[model samples]
Target: MSARSLASPQSAGEQKKKLADSLIKKFNKKFNGPLNNPHLSSIIVAEVGKLLQKAKISPGDLEQVEAKISREAVSESSAVLRNEDVRLRKIKAEMSSKGGLPAALLSKEDRKILPKELKKTIASPKKKPAARVSVNMLENTVRARNAQLDKQKAKHTSVFSSLGMVGPATPDSDAGNILVGAKSLPLDQAVDPWSVLIMHDVKKYEDERKQREEQKRLQREQWKRELDDQVKINERKKKEAAMEEVKYAEEEQDQLRVADIQEKKKKEAKMMINTKLKEERAKTVAELQEQKRRQLEEQKEEEKSEVRRMEAEIARAERRQQRKREEEAERAKRLQEENKEQRKMREEERKKKHRMDLEYAASQARMLDDLERRRLEALGKIKEKMKTIEVMGDTLGHSILEKEEEDERRAEMWRQAYEKKQLKVCFFRVCWCRGACNVCVEAVRDRGGEMEKVN
Candidate 1:
């Protein structure tokens, strides 16, 4: 068994087996097995080489070992050839001691050394020689038989004898001479052996028939005498039988008349019984027909009632469907109205919010304008008051009293402007340094814009 077959258990039976094995098997049958996969073979060879390295074996050593084996094989083959030559010489020497050279090649001097056994075998007659003698003897026996047959039936021989028991032989012919003769049949002609056997049997039958006919002719004459006596005895028996037949005919005639009368009575009784049975059968059929008619009428009534019930149910269902349709329409209309009202309210709320935003924006713009107006008006009034004080001081060149009055007037104006407009510029200018902080920068920018506006 192969490795695959040995590994399989008997009970497991047939299996396509491992996935890889099945794939490889199909691949090999389709491709050319391992030979077609050169890369795979190369990888396997490489792995094998690595494995052999563990045993300290290399490809070079493998080549040298193979070469040494080949050399030894050549030497052994040469020795074998030398031994074979010696063996052939010994065989020839034995043959020379036992017998001379074969007769085909023997010389006059070598012929005397021939073994006695071989000489006897060469001289004796074989199967072919003996068979030739037997054939000749058979031909002589056939000739003698043909002569006897001709003497018995010489006048009977004709052209048609070939198809008859004698087989076309004349008085001067030998047995089988027609079958073997060159002129008798075409060369290589096929003949059925059965035809020859049948002809021989027919000849034997003709002779047997002749003897049986002679014997039967004597028996026929003897049988005719016995038959004449038997006829007289049969005539006496016929006369007695004719008397008995007359008496039997009369008794049969009486019995036939009685049987005919009884048959007529039995026929009448059968006719009466058939009439009664027919009447019962007719009555039963009529009752069955009436019952079937009643069942059909009842079925028809039930069908009519069911049809009416179904029509009423359909009407009610239509009414319910119409009501449901109306209800759905009403609900849809109401929902449409609700959705419209909600949209209207949302639009009004959006308009109100827009108005509020516009109002707030206008109020902010008005407040900014008012603040700008107050600052400009206050700055202009302060400038006017300061110019009046400078002019009054120029007119009263040496008047201290007048200078004191101007200072009091300037303080009064500052107080009044601060109270009326909440102006803090004068106080800021008195306390602030130039660009000292956020307050000073914002005050300077505001004051510069106010002064420009006033100017």
Candidate 2:
């Protein structure tokens, strides 16, 4: 039987031991460190052993617990790493969003809200409108002209009064004159209510024009402030982007190093596994060869045993045949002696029977002779009667003659029938006697032959 067939199934402890051994080998080959550093395999193995001993756990249960812990640890670690990667990626995206080109470096197309035409207009340099003519100066010039007109009118009214050529002036006329004067005077100097209303309208118009110019000036200043802020923000973003690029390059280098290490470890592991498989296959082949040799030996022994058994059986069969032949010879001798006495008695009986048959044959021959003589005498009597009938047939009438002839013929026929019957009986009796004599003679000859053999 094979060792595997003889042994029980491997226990958890044994499996664990095998796993540990494999792990130790893998670690010894995989770990790369300072020459003075302790081997990773020894440290890991010792730590795990110490932990398991402290737990005082059974191997079977420990295996299950270890497997569960390993799965959970791997899952948790992977989840954490995945979350960290996601967070880092989100931060990188935010940083990229914050970083942008400064206005000085940006193209018109890059401006988010500004149209190309507007950007061009803004870029083109133009002289500021020389400080807008102040509305107050225009108001002052209008007041001075109104004062000179009022003075010339007053002087002309006085000269007309002195010449006494004044016509009847009613109150209505005076009111009309005051209205005309109010229309020409400045708002501050005017006494008429209409003059004040007209002056209020002129001032309101001037104030509205000044308000529009101030709004335009404020808009220009706001645009300048926004552009400055944008430039500062762009500069900051550029600096941050440069820093991020350097950080990303360093991370990529680290990842490449890690990947190279992992690849080397995988190659080493694959080589170790291949070597182990080859060793196992060779060991299995040797075991199979051993089993085959054992089977061949067993077959050869069985064949030799079978040959011995067959030879023994053949010998027994031959002996049985020899014994059977000897028994048959003895029985045949006894039967021969018994047959000798039987043959003597049979000879005596056959001789007596032959004598009786001879006597019977002699009597039968005498009887046959007697019957022949009687038959011949009857035929002679029949012939004589036929001659007599023939003689009487001539004397009788023709009919009577015919009757006699028929009678005679009938009588002759009857006589001939009787002779034939008697001859047949005699012939049969003679044949029977001859046959009995022949049988007795043959029996007597056979007995004589047996007697000679016995002598």
Top model by TM-score, which number?
Answer: 2
Clashing pairs in 2: none
Per-residue alpha-carbon lDDT of model 1 for 1-455, expressed as tens digits?
A: 12344245554324323422453444333222212445433433443344333424433343333223223322333343344344434434544565422232333222222333323322331222110112233455556655665565656643323323335445554433544433333212534334465566557655855875675465444433333443444445444434434543454455456546755865875687578658856976896699679868966885686587876677576775687589669967976896687688667856865886687557645744663464345335434533654464344333333434644564465456556875444333332122222343444455665311210
lDDT per residue (tens digit) for residues 1-455 in model 2: 12232233557568456655764454333321111124333454664465334323443333333333323322332343344344434433443465422222233223332223324434432332222223344565557655764665565552223212233333322323433322333334435433454577668756865875675566445544554454454455445435544553564466456546756865886687578658866976896699679868966885686587976677576775687589669867876886687688657856865886687557645744663464345335434533553454343333334544654564465345435653212111222122233332333353453211110
Q: What value does the lDDT take at residue 305 in candidate 1?
A: 69
Please report how far candidate 1 places residue 94 from its true position, in Å.
Answer: 99
| Clash statistics: count for each candidate | 2, 0
Instruction: Give the Cα-based TM-score of candidate 2 against the true structure.
Output: 0.23
Model 2 C-alpha RMSD to native: 73.4
